[model samples]
Target: MSRIRPQVRISRRLSTTAGVAVTTATLLTAALSPAAHADTRPSRATAIENAAAALLAHAASLGLTSAENTSVRDVIVDKDGTQHVRYDRTYHQLPVLGGDFVVHLAPDGAYRSADRSTRAPISLASIVPKIASPEAAGLAVNALRAANLGTVLKQVKAKPELIVDALHGTPRLAWRTNAVGLDSLGNPVARTVLTDARTGAQIDAWDSIETAAGDGKSLYSGTVPLQTTPSGSSYQLKDPTRGNTYTGDAQGQTDACILSICISRAPAVLFTDADNHWGSGTTADRASAAVDAQYGTDETWDYYKNVQGRNGIGGDGKGSYNRVHYGSNYNNAFWDDSCFCMTYGDGDGTTFGPLVALDVAGHEMTHGVTSKTAALTYSGESGGLNEATSDVLGTLVEWYANNPSDPGDYLIGEKIVKPGFGHTALRYMDKPSKDGSSADYWSSSVGNLDVHYSSGVANHFAYLLAEGSGPKTINGVSYDSPTYNGSTITGIGRDKLGKIWYRALTVYMTSSTNYKGARTATLNAAKDLYGAGSTEYDTVAAAWSAVNVN
Candidate 1:
């Protein structure tokens, strides 16, 4: 099985300035100051807004001109009061692609350092498009159609927005168009096309759907407990505890779309049961699959909330829904941002069973998490990172669950892949190359591989980071992870790995980050969480080197 998603571009530059060290006397003096007593600390939002305003006021130092403006994308205030502010830039009112950057400030609001997506100056010749929006949109639709060659597309629609393409070489006026329609399977297919506004040539294009190769009987996890909502005499497969997240029976229906319009969408008919007991742990019962889907969703939600401190997938305490039995023998699962939901395929039965495994559920939901945070473009190295992020965290989610039936392992989708698939699992984090297509070490050509296979680099790094090199048995599963440079590495434990990677994804990484960027992000994250030169920080560096990232 394979997966596809959208893409972005990134190049980073670091600018640092020394901050004055705060002394105990300075702190005591400030604590006793009348202004300190009179001024209550501002709200987090206010402080971040104030910081953005201050940073904008000194735009020249940040490599920005008066013609550029910024809006906040994300903000992180550390335990030590250090602030990291991420912003997106607009040049002359046109969005600047790859013009995003993060500014780090000291506790005293002094400039410390910055990570810019691109160091190139943004100065487009003109915002006006000679090719026009309609023409650009037509080209985008054609590109989309060309990409999906044998499939008949319906409800085809293309929407083009003009932007400054700072992502590619030399910032220039371009049209970023999203062309969407339904594939032959009735699955919504979309491509985001970037076209040179002046020349009317296609610059770049990528699939917008975030997908995973594989889902349930109560399938993989055996029989699991579920939280349901009472609706009259029957119970709805909705968990009130986890933000009303419910599992709906798609009833073998698929989505219908034309261009941007979704004419006949699959209805998430609430799965209702008279007795509260859901699923017989077999596909013979419809509630059986629903049970697995609901359980997987619950475990994923709990893993993020309990281990990662995220309130929900978006960290906003909002729940995302799940749709099971999506399409007849659909064979794939996806996390759709537009619907804020997870949809699973029933599989062709020979290649796969139900697409609702716990790790698969976690993997799909983590896509939502990535979209909310780094928004790593789903192509090239960044796309690989995006997929690897999900794999890493999804593995952690399985470990966090500690379910007896599906004990955690470094393998992904082990429960979903059928015997006819000719593989034990969809992916192996400890030795990704075992699957035949994945790359175990980083190389220039690694980015040229599919995002799933390229993700092997990070997955290998994560396995080495958590379990180290050489053979070992974790939870009865054996692994012998090797390093790229043949250097021995000692395990740092998965708990620390989770903390470091989560922080990197949420605080340090940008949308366009690549393999090298990921190394930097994780190193910075380790330094933030475990201190510079700490064992954990050193291990993070060693792990990346083991994966040939350095």
Candidate 2:
């Protein structure tokens, strides 16, 4: 999202902490450093230090006690000197898992408010663990094995880290372990398991690899221009203009990783051609699929940079590489934060093609964006919102590209799913229930559904916010959106909708934000974009209500 400053007023009493002073001079120095020169801005290091200092100065006001410490995770500064500082906390030197939060500051460095992952206070009867680390590792490994039942795992390994488990319930000592191994297909699979330190019981376990299912044709956008780097004599499939983001052939291999360490990573063999002209429009040529992958990356990069003012997926001006032709007839694509890259699969011809469609690329890349920003927990309502965020922005990326061959539409993965798949599209944002599994509106039982299907509520809301309810046709695609309440909403346009949602995701939403929290975040975002009671703000409320979010 763009670093747009909002004139928001948050009223809260600041807790007093003696011997700590955040002077105006310090704030001015940090804020003005970015504009020290007309052509230059503050370095990343400088910004981070400044943000850390700012947060530490007001630790007490943020509900941080003397036993707690804060470390800066991210810093976002607006042109008007407004600041959003993200932080990860620790208690008595132990890492706090759900202790992350964001502190908002006005232009003058005045405290606005703080959004925390949890409101529960951090305390422990004892820091000592009844369960040993090695035992925890074994439990984690067993959990991983159970997840991959009926498969023989190779090179299995597990590493455990002691942490305070604030995310799952009351804060308590816990062991967070990452288990990695090669699956039956020789594909690398990893899962993170959380086990109670005192009790041997498993608290939670999730696959570390984030994934979305779909496929697409080779050169799905037809012939498109590419930006490649000249390596020695031939041009390599690397775009230096976009942080040297290169597309590589995985040679049907997957990377085995544990946390940030990869034991055996598939070679990202760079694609080099004698001439820069990369691909023909057929799957017979490997470069054809590579072309679609690279083009999708380019368009996604441009969409965020040009449309949202985000420098990159991480908002750090660094490009992420893409790996295509990833396994034999693999029917899925995924984003690996551990590898910081995108991996696409070659789908079975009958059901899917190459899985490198523009929208698919956009969708997968957006997962990285969400990780860098809100880092929404990938379960329940937050997980649904996470998926919806990708779908919403991915669709916007398609429209931003405006490629005639693959025109913008709300039908996701349409180019990917063939007739054999028995579905017109992976999802229908206009009416998510059309997919036969997705929810049409929010209900108490919505959270019980899989994240992909639960995402329908927000997806439906986004469609109504952009296109409104009732029948409509745009770019030759017909849509009939219904509302929970029989109220018609007049769209304020996709551009405004994007801005509002982006602001909510980056500025207002927290890691644990649910459907209700999402509604609040979007409303706050709308109020920030337009004035409160403005048509845009009212429309945002109306749209959420239409999805039964109210």
Report how far residue 389 has shifted in candidate 2, in Å: 1.3
Q: What C-alpha lDDT, on a 0 to 100 scale, does residue 195 get in candidate 1?
A: 97
* Reference-based lDDT, each prediction: 0.79, 0.78
Model 2 gets an lDDT of 0.78
State the lDDT at 382 in candidate 1.
84
Candidate 2, residues 457-479, lDDT tens digits: the string is 99999989998999989999999
Scanning candidate 2 in windows of ten residues, the lowest lDDT window is 1-10
Could you give me the TM-score of model 1 versus the true structure? 0.89
| Model 2 TM-score, 2 decimals | 0.89
Estimate the Cα RMSD of every predicted model relative to the unseen true structure: 7.1, 6.4
What TM-score goes with each of the models? Answer: 0.89, 0.89
Q: Per-residue lDDT for 1-550 in model 1, tens only?
A: 4442311113222222222110110000001112324444343454454455556555666678756766666565665667776777778778888787777777667677778777788776678899999999899999999988988998788888899987777889999998888767766677889999999988877777667750223767876777778889988888889989998889988877422446677879988888887777888888777777788788888877777667787666778898889877877888887778888888888878888888888888999888766778777788889999989998898998898999999998888888988888988999999988999999999988888899999999999899899998988998989888889999899999999998899778887899999999999999988899999999999999999999
